[model samples]
Target: MENVLSSLIPPHGGKLVYRVLQSAPGKSHLDSLAKIRLDQNKQMDLEQIAVGTYSPIEGFMGEEDFRSVINTMRLADGTVWPLPIVLDVSVETADQLAIGEVVGLSDEQDEVMALLHLEEKFCFDKEETVIKLYGTDSLDHPGVRMIYEMQPVLLGGQVDLIRGRKSETRAYELTPKQLRRLFDDRGWSSVLGFHTRNIPHKGHEFIQLKALEDENCDGLLVQPVVGKKKSGDFKPEYIIKSYEKMIENFYPREMVVLAAFSTFSRYAGPREALFTALCRKNFGCSHFIVGRDHTGVGNYYDPYASHRIFDQFPDLGLKIVKFDEIFYSKKLNQYVQGNSLFPEDENDTLRMISGTQARAMLLRGESPPVWFMRPEISSVVLDSVRSGIQVFEG
Candidate 1:
């Protein structure tokens, strides 16, 4: 059948969506919708779509929120799960979705509105219905999907809604060009992007420092994920503060740029790591530091799998700073390379701590080793936990 996107956008300009679809095939319309009901959650399956103008897509189409349609999926009981397809959007598509329009979607057959549910209520205003949609592709995320699906609306919202906040670290909005220029000016000959929700532990510090020293990269972009992380995670603002404090205290001001990555964490591990690099590349990063279990949850991915992706990255136009996992070796009494057991420190062996272990120790009112954290920061974190006030909210 003719692609549904063809009917949705200008004949000539809808080609990008067509390209995206061709690269990632969508499920049939029937299957897509069924999977939505079955999952009882919104997901971007390739099949679902929304119609709108161009300008709106640019403003409202976000990777954090996009409502698309996909194919139906089935469960063991033979229950059907319709594919949760969302409309994917980008800056260009946003403009197309909002040409001379206030609301992007149509009410009639040619431009019918897709009813989106948010917070238990249905809003007919197409502009307010964007929700997070998950898909398998690394580069395409809810933020990117929103840009793809609701760009026209978001472009409008970008001006209309001004109250919701981003953290201070990301508060200074830089044009894409300015961002590129900032990297160039800083001698960030190779920008290496690093994303995390936690404060820097020794392992993270070790690997990042190694990137600067070993890889001879010009600079590092300490981009922290400041969006919806799982519960028990640090708040974006807190993370921003932590990074700011660390940079001010430890890292050279000229060598690093601390910025907030305003996207939620998917914990997709290796794929997520690559996606992070591509996003940074979009922001002018030439290199990305991929640590062990970049975004893995529950031991699903091999630690080395995260770095192995670098092998294929040359074909993908992104470079990575791959290092063996840094860990604290109890026997050596210091951190050692994951691939080897010898102490990294020639004289004083100081084992590094893991984020997971740090969290576990903190919840129990224990101080993480100095090698794992700064004493002052760890004290503040522990005190916050003890007060029943969570310093970090995932």
Candidate 2:
């Protein structure tokens, strides 16, 4: 039998999707089709889909795929897709659109971004969608709130990006195909992917180090999600800069690389965790580290829910390295697992900071305790904030 968790990873759908249009459409072409303006988050989804970031899922999901994903965590074809990746449209827009018609997908500014080959349009049970996707329908949940605010109709189709974002040359802003090529060029067969949305704290460094060392991995990718994040989370630019500093000063030069994952956070807890890891697999990461509340928010998920969900997919085609929630133990003079020598009652000996707290500290021009955040990493955040840069999402 073959090693199902082999490091030689393949794209989720076996073949990577590349639907980028090589050139801009002609005037008549743009004028010929109906246009739908995509919000920023949806625009990011379009680009990712166009580049195989969500491989095997070439476009916004049809009703069949959406229902299958929401109810079973699988695509209609039984592919293990943890989240429903669908395009929502206003009921009026859906009414105007007809089946089999091609539509132009544009930004709010009306710049033509892509062409959606519309295959299906359907209404869904909003309450069921929220409950299934989030495990909650309470508006208190951020993901649930976003879902509740969405339009009632969904459009499903394949897309062709109009060669935009190609101007972006940063190595960190890479697509799945480009990322896989980078891993191959580095000769990394068993590279580990570490996901983050915050500036690198000592806890994060500790987790990555433990994962790298424990796994005996050939390489490590410090991939940070640089898309729309919660309000208090660090901005993408600073997150990238902090890691740039972390890798420069602390990590081995050749064994690590930093890349920005251009996908937004859904705060779907365990489901998003599984979704992110599979995305890493498409990016050629053979293994992924799931730590703490893995993509969770506001006490909505069990801390180790991400760890347990991996068991459901025996042939996940990737390996998940689960780590206990870690904190800086002053007694040990460094970061350690929660189940370490220090007991829970020893509050004075443990140091931990939430992202909201960290942001507030930066706003106050104060460096977090050196135990929780490195001076260098903290300096990057402080600089970004002090310079009037929008360092946090609002």
Candidate 3:
């Protein structure tokens, strides 16, 4: 039974989608793409689809899929895809392109990214997308703001990655196939995946360790998002270095694997949490740890919304390990879940530190106490801050 459950979950549509051009196109084909350019977000989306990171999605969503996903959180074919990955282009660009035509995707520097085979061009209801996906249409939400800023036109079709380039985080990035092979090679049948965008604190470690033990899993995967994030989030380099130090000196190395996930953060709170879990499921994780305010931003979402959202998707194909908020208990001299503590006098100690406080402390040249964070990890952050490194620069 364990072996059966350990078998990798299939890519959403029962096969891994790789739409990249296997061989170089002719000069004529190349010339066609030179006429149009794609932005960084679309480039990233194409790369993701080509590599099967966003498997089951062969290309950008068509009008049918887009409308269905916005109204029902499923594709037109009834596939349970929560997020719509459509390529938005300006009206002028759309005017120059037509169905059955192909366009070249490029970056700001004129570096070719992909060739989009246009299948459909349509307009989306931005207001509806914001309401359905984010539960609010207010521009105050980053995801909503992004939609409002995008061009009114949407391009739908398959993409042939023509000029894929290795990313700086490539050293830490692992495809689904590679990760599955790693898990098999390590004799790990049940792996718990933990996703994070910020530096890991003691609470984070406590939850990960506890989940590993409670689930009696074979290993833990510390997969951090290393793509475009809000300005105040931890830098990819700092996040990677800190985790390396923490895993080497603190964690049981044999039971843990660290990798980077390159994907943009939508900050859609609960919906984003579900989307992330599906990605991890495709990456061969048998279980995922969902903590308090998982994938949330500011106070837009309920504290336990991420946990509750799991109830709505009973067939997500991945086990969700729900964890309560963890805080330091001075009486116990260790981290404990919020519900485990007994009532005590005002003098009794139970304190929790926010990520904001941790960052502020690091920026102030102060290290979080050993109880709240490992010295090695905090030291790396301190060093980066002292060097005047802009850890959150996009």
Candidate number with greatest lDDT: 2
Which wins on TM-score, candidate 2 or candidate 3? 3
The candidates, ranked best first by TM-score, are: 3, 2, 1
Off by over 4 Å in 3: 1-6, 344-347
Residues 1-394 of candidate 3 have per-residue lDDT tens digits of 1134445555565666667677777876676563556665666777778777777787888999889977877788877778889888778888888799877777777766677789999998888788888888888888889888988999898888876655788888887767877888898878899998878889889998999999999999999988777767788888888888888888999999999888897868987888888788777788999988998877899989999988987876779999888888787788888767666634668888567777778768898998888888888888767888776654
| Ten contiguous residues with the weakest lDDT in model 2 | 163-172
Task: For each candidate, give its TM-score against the true structure.
Answer: 0.58, 0.92, 0.93
Better of 1 and 3 by TM-score: 3
In model 2, how large is the Cα lDDT of residue 339?
Answer: 61
- How high is the lDDT of residue 374 in model 1? 81
Largest TM-score belongs to which candidate? 3
Error of 3 at 45 (Å): 1.7
The sequence of per-residue lDDT tens digits that candidate 1 reaches over residues 187-253 is: 4556666767787787877778777777677778787765556677766666666677778888876
- In the predicted model 3, the residue pairs found to clash are 38-106
Name the lDDT value of residue 231 in candidate 2. Answer: 71
